[model samples]
Target: MTDHTTTPPFDAADHLPDELIERIRARAARHDAENTFPHDDLDDLRSAGYLGILVPQDRGGAGLGVAEAAILQQRLAGASPATALAVNMHLVWTGVAKVLRDRGIDDLAFVQEGAAAGEVFAFGISEAGNDLVLFGSDTDAAPLPDGGYAFTGTKIFTSLSPAWTHLGLHGLDTSSPDGPRLVYAFVPRSAESEGTIEVRDDWDTLGMRATQSRTTVLSGAVAPADRVVRFVPPGPNPDPLVFGIFSVFEVLLASVYTGIARRALDVAVATAGARTSKKTGKTYAQDPDIRWHIADMALAYDALPPQIASLAADVDALADHGARWFSLLAGLKHRATATAKRVVDDAMLVAGGSSYFTRSELSRLYRDVLAGAFHPSDPESAHATLASAWLGPIES
Candidate 1:
């Protein structure tokens, strides 16, 4: 993860020190066991200015790009996947703002300023069954007299639910004179929005429990005119907002899962060296089959960081890939998640039956890795994108 040949000239250790990583790692199991959000971890990250890493340095942030952020996320995930995943939601907004600003689109400058000012932003894009993803929304965006819009819809998997100050969301504005438009906006989570935003405390899950990415009920939550960012058509387009979100989300998600694979490999290596075979009276590391398995894990893992770094660097450099961007990003996400799952499974086998226990770290990783498959650009959608890219769109 430390190798950053294709990334920016930044060091992950400076922002996420070894001590801080270990501290977060120590708290992960407890938070997981209790099914509680990692409040302390968030506090520590905020104090370290990790929340504003993507904001411009002049604006009081680390001023890093997606490449650097990807490296930092990998390090963080190596310690605590849930914390890294939850924090990804906040980073997504700042990353999007950065993406927009890099291309001279300053509409989201407020997002950068907000992040630099210690305001936590939560991603409120996910819905229960609106599979169109960035292309469509089930949420209703009612136009207001003062040039604002009121959003009413339930956003599922709203990460950082309890601590977010701003909720970045999108809704469909069918009332517009020019047909349905997807309105991307930000709403505050304060006393004024008491009845509008309801966060259901039902995030208890099989793993990654520290995230607490609960369901959010947006009952006419208002986004002031100044905060409303985009008004794109209700379908696929080359809008910077959509590209920024998809690119950043896919890269960061890949980084987290890659980190999980790295951790699993390390654990497997250690287990192989320490555990002795009852039949041969030798360490498992000496067995040819175990060596091959570890090697396979290493091979699968070694390819991820470079891909993540290259794509992220391309994004920061604003390289145009046309329609190919979706296919490339979708493939990266699919490979990262699938490879991480395989590595974790192999690691569990190497660690033997002891890893099956709930107390084992590999067991936790086993469950956490399963969640990677369920994220956006899921296996089905990813395959579709790739097929369309290589074989051309299916004939009507």
Candidate 2:
């Protein structure tokens, strides 16, 4: 419970006041029910300068580090998971830019400037069956005559699809003289990209509906030479761009789910205090069994935030974990998502059958929490990464 208001740089309370949070939370249900994106929420957040939290102060941003960003993200997620999740993509780019600038590599400085100017950046790395993640891409990156790259492929789960001003994506450049390479670039959503990008209105899902993370089809969408950020050999390698994306993405994602768990716990506590057990003529809060359930939920939920904070602090400090970074980050994400699921499940049970109703908060939380498993570091990928780190890769 660090008082973020007194922490320095910027105040979370000032940026996201209680009234603003309540307004965002108030609209979450309507957006979820209507399966629409939170345009109003986004407008409010933009006005608050939230989209630039990671940009440096000199760059007209809050100048917060990953640690503080994690805290603010948790607060936002507690109010509206969909809004927080959608905004995470924008934060990812700013965080990545911060990481690079801190490390003396200013490849993504434009990202910081763009964010500070209220330009939304969407992550466009995900492709169908592209298990290689950041190490590789299925999208085709053709070299243009002007040193730009024309990316032709489909990217799934493109968050902030409707309003993103710039789309950050990676693709495989097979014709490069240096052999196959992965080109990381950003395509601005402008008249130049009118016929090149197609956003499908196919974001209906089980939960987190306000995210509107839809499919993006890119047919020769161009990233001007100035916007092309990195050119690295495909396969696992030590590149700042890769590490920046992975680290910021994982920590922020863990923060979002951790927030969901916190909300579920709070709801359970309120429900338990209000609901009386007819069998014992006492409230569920007074029941030993119910107390234990809450204790378990708290125990599981309590461990996540500290873990995220510590790792995020290390990232901000540029502590080198070397090859261990991947395992540590993946493990953190895995634990957060898994623990959140358990906490939400326990909460539903504590809140009783009424929580099973379609419109119940717990019911929506249950569905929102499931999307955690399907994020970048799936349970399988996380376990494999951990196994490789602890047990070493299997003998080829």
Candidate 3:
């Protein structure tokens, strides 16, 4: 992996502020200990316009692209993976909203405005028995008498559900029982009508404790039909497949994992410098073996970004064929997620028993980075889909 550490003239946007970084460092420990969401750090992101970095300028946003967004998320994940995981959903939803706007669905202006203003938005996908399909939510929406729909089902792992103004829900339309009619809706979290949508504060996990990835149960929750922004046709939409939407998620998630790895490496290096081995009177870092582990950790962390960047560039070029792009995207996400898990796992090993203690930052990094493996675009499904594409019968 290339070492850009000595490279000068790096773009400032590619890095985060020292204060924010410090806050993330401090908050990572505090949030993990308290097992609560990182509200303070989120406020910093909002004030810095980082939350709306990907929103279009017309929608009162900075209009940044995926590359920039990925960079911001990577840096933030290094500080706190849970916060990064929780917040990145907003950008994903904003991107979806932008697509809706381009398709002439202007009724979602409120959501766009709220996103631009830094309002948190949770993604309601992933069900208990869905077998780790992130987008394969079990929630169902049935057409109502007033041209709207009544949504009812339980959505699990809804990151950022505890404090968010909006929710991007993906469900099937039961009214048309013949085939899968995927529907997307933007529900206002604060609305009285949405009271039926209960947020379950039961997101106790091995990592990403601050994500508030609790269960959200929607029981006959009526959402305006106008709020239905997009209805994805059953089977495959080439855009989601080709544009690498799933792959992008994987890549983005990998970025977060890399960040965690990076932080773990940093803490390890710092600790090694000061920590003396119990048997030998020498510093633990002085050992050649310890140095090699650090080198390997650095290599893994450095190798990930370029791979993701290359895939993203490919994705950007395939904007015309959404299906091909989405398929490729899925592949990318799969690779990155698995790679990230390995990198962080190695980081934890390198850190040794020090990482096991609550006082060590590596402890939290170890926990937070593991979540990437199980994030929406699971590695197993990605591989299965890729395998199907390779071995399945070719379309006539």
Candidate 4:
């Protein structure tokens, strides 16, 4: 899995090169088998400049938008969902930086520069029982005299924990002289001098094992004055950081699961073609039932890629959906993940006993796809968001 003699350079297209994807794909199962982070996968992607895909070309990076990133993610996820998911955490930061810079908010320029300079950034917003999602945080952001902030909270599901150089996080600073301020900041590993980020080796789960998105314990992890980016009132106000994170994260996440659906559909088709029916002496592909199941899978899977692509492009172009954007973006993530689960189930049935094996890719996908349902803007929250969009806020 560590074949690093030579490989492709970092000039990825709209879709990643198939050979490189296959190389990353080859390492996926081993990483998952060991419940380890895909270090080789990360190294290969880094060599291909994938981590800097959102950095501006002027900054010695790809300068691509979320739309292009979504396409590439779909391709990557077809091979490895865990890899895609881990990479998604990094992309969120660069994508946010791009959104900020595009709107003339240079506060996150350091994040972009860091990405281009080969620094891995992790999304550190998740907290236990914090269902308010991005609207609030349990993390404490204590303001420092030098203008920086110190974060003390347990952030769960910190993807790329072992490798990330910066963690983009938000915390509530209630002890401020004025009022509670939700500070959004990037805490670098250098903060080990002042504090430490303790990453627990506790990511054992049903699937996506290769992600190694372990729990993080921030013991006064400090975001220096220069790294402190946003200071805002908490609880669901209008902010570009909010929009950028939701838009980029949901869109890219949807792309990953959409690719899962695509791969499942393709695998089902392949299985149908190769497996012969014991009853009719014909291939499963010839059976009307199998064809219909495959068709149903395709039907469910078809609408997502176009939806992901269009909405991602809209985000890049800065299209104004106003209050509707959250619903639209979150809705895409909800639908894609849900659809991928259904498609994977169907494909597993199509593959029969082989797919039932725990090591089978479809089996892994079945478990990995379930995680999407657990991400932000989950089904219940997504429905609430949509209902609020269509019918106005709840009666209160």
Q: What is the C-alpha lDDT of each candidate?
A: 0.92, 0.92, 0.69, 0.86
What does candidate 1's lDDT look like per residue over 1-396, in tens digits?
344334458667789988899999899889989999999999999889999999999888999989999988988998999999999989999999999999999898888888888899999999999899899999999989988899999999999998999999999999988899999999998886523788999998988888899999988899989988999998888899999999999999999999999889988999999999999999999999999999999899989999999999999999999999999999999999999999999999889999999898999999999999989999999999999999998999
Which runs of model 2 end up more than 4 angstroms from their true locations? 1-10
Q: Best candidate, lDDT-wise? A: 2
Q: Candidate 4, residue 286: CA error in Å?
A: 0.6
Q: Report the candidate with higher lDDT, 1 versus 2.
A: 2
On lDDT, the stronger of 1 and 3 is 1
TM-score of 4: 0.95
Q: Across residues 1-396, which tens digit of lDDT does each residue of candidate 3 receive? A: 112442223453434676777677777878888889888878888888777766788878877656656666777887788888888777677655554455454555766788888787777767888873434547888877766777899888888877877777777885675766777776777567743888987877788898888888888777677777666654544434212335445556666766666666777777778878888889978978888877877776677677666665454443454334544666666665666666666666666776778777777776676677676556666666777667774468
At residue 203, give the lDDT of candidate 1.
Answer: 93
- Model 3 Cα shift for residue 147 (angstroms): 3.1
2 or 4: which has the higher TM-score?
Answer: 2
lDDT for position 38 in model 4: 83
Predict model 4's lDDT versus the native: 0.86
Error of 1 at 188 (Å): 0.4
lDDT minimum window of 10 residues, candidate 2: 1-10
TM-score head-to-head 1 vs 3, winner = 1
> lDDT per residue, candidate 4, 1-396, as tens digits?
111212223334433677888888788778877889888888888888888989999987898888878878888998899999999999988999898888888888888888888899999999999998788899999889999888999999999978988899999999978888889998888744488888898999888888888899888899999999888788887798888888899999998898888888888898899999899999999998888999999889878878887898899898888888989988999999999999999999889999988778788878889898999889999999899988999786
